[model samples]
Target: MAVDLENPSNYLTTRVRQAVNWGRKYSLWPLPFGVACCAIEFMSTVSSYNDISRFGAELVRFSPRQSDLMIIAGTISYKQAPILKTIYAQMAEPRWVIAMGACASSGGFYNNYSTLQGADRVIPVDMYVAGCPPTPENLLYALTQIQERVEREGLVPAAVRHAGRVQV
Candidate 1:
């Protein structure tokens, strides 16, 4: 192949930072914190039927220490809030969180004091999927939204930007 000095198309910027971000966007290691009925739907989203792997998020990491993406799938009682916060703190940097259903987003129907109004109160959420127990499709859509956001934002830490803005 003849080299063209003036050609922009011949170059693919492979800077170390951008290269890492590219991998992070595609190979999101999800740590599912499934708690209730929504957990069931989360399962379907990862199953062979829906195949979340198509988005490069197939490997589900049970250990928060090893994962970058956290999906909170159900209600969080007041007593559990602290625990959730601890777990969030344990996860490595460049982590992103997905509040996967109405319950995780806003405590669903548990409007009482025992249930935290939202998981966001404890940890910042990068995406929210609406539904009592959102459909697998909705969850998939949420994943795509997260991917797009990641693409736009690169390796920006969700905690730094949204730490003070986790109102939802």
Candidate 2:
């Protein structure tokens, strides 16, 4: 069944799966990969006014092993691709990635040879927030989308990386 994030009350599912997803959606530990102008906007999302904590993602973890979501909020150079992949590899199962800007999503205006056209070239992106520097509200919206997807997927982890690099 399709579970709408805005109104899950209308949907029904097995109690166990619902319970698990309930806990998971309310507790998403995000790891911020900030490296450019968009990083500043991302910080604003965690500020008192925007308060990312309200979404249950207040615990911004630096360790990949401890985080379930990764917010890539800047341009990714080829030099940084390996590092990004390494951190992603370290994250546990059911991990999510949000490309939080034009730069992170498609390298923005840095269409140079050194810059990676998109983080998706090196990692799988679960969500993409457009704009040279997307507003904090957009990031928060992306977060909600992640929660929605998590709830919809139920007990099954969808971000599993298979040998063939399939994103299911």
Candidate 3:
């Protein structure tokens, strides 16, 4: 089963899983759930300077139905938790979530009764970008990490995949 490295046919001999993962990794349409200060940073990430479009996530769809990635980029107050859950539930299957910023990831300095502590309390998060308000570059780096995860693991629904894990 020795294969020639220089052969052109070898280039096309990718497995079905790899092919599917490749397509899913690049076509992630993000649903930016911006709610607070971190929202501003998320906006900057998509702006011309950061240009998230370069990674195939330029189409920031507001409607959950049209998106596959949910970027929760701010604080999630108790009142807003239900709304966030509703939106996450509405997103199409094979959806992924990113907790973008300290606020969204763990309530940041707003460790009060109103804030939910973390976006993961409402929906499963696949990637978490840290910082009170993470820079656009940080957001971009997180996106690339997510891309790498998708490429390696394929698009399995987080709930189904992590059902065995204990929720903390």
Candidate 4:
């Protein structure tokens, strides 16, 4: 049903599903997997100037078990892929990943035997922020997109999410 903005009662009639979605969308906890230059921008995104807290993601958790969002902001070498997978596995259900920057998204210029072609090769990615080192605004925008996805899809079981990466 459509809500009538002119009527105050419409606000009170909000659906529980929408309310739950709103709560989950705003209260996202992120795991910062910063490994290179893009990590600098990731740090700046959380600084007072950028204020990632405004979106309720101010509390950055280093533990994978505590965070639902993982921001992979740098290159992922083959040696590190297993570690990243382990971290992703440790995270609670309904986890999400953001490949922040060209390096994290496609191994950037380090397309050699050491670096993985992309984070997707190791773990499932929910979003990809393009650029050598994306700006804070870009990261924020990616967060917003994640929020939107959560709002639309709501929370689902880990088995149902299907990131497509089989954990060996």
Best by TM-score: 4
Q: In lDDT terms, how accurate is model 4?
A: 0.90
Model 3 ranges with Cα > 4 A deviation: 1-11, 164-168
State the lDDT of candidate 2 residue by residue for 43-162, as single tens digits.
899999999999999999999999989999899999998999899889887788999999889888988999999998888888999888999999999999999988878534435432
Give TM per candidate.
0.86, 0.86, 0.89, 0.90
For candidate 3, list the clashing residue pairs, or say none.
none
Model 2 misplaced stretches (Cα beyond 4 Å): 1-14, 158-168
- Identify the runs in model 4 with alpha carbons over 4 angstroms from their true place: 1-11, 163-168
lDDT of 4 by residue, 68-120 (tens): 99999899998898899899899988888899999899988988999999998
The superposed Cα distance between candidate 2 and the true structure at residue 135, in angstroms, equals 0.2
- Every candidate's CA RMSD: 4.3, 6.1, 4.0, 3.5
Model 4 vs. true fold: TM: 0.90
TM-score for predicted model 1 compared with the true structure: 0.86
Give the clash count for each candidate: 0, 0, 0, 0
For candidate 2, the per-residue lDDT at 31 reads 96
- On a 0 to 100 scale, what is the lDDT of residue 54 in model 2? 95
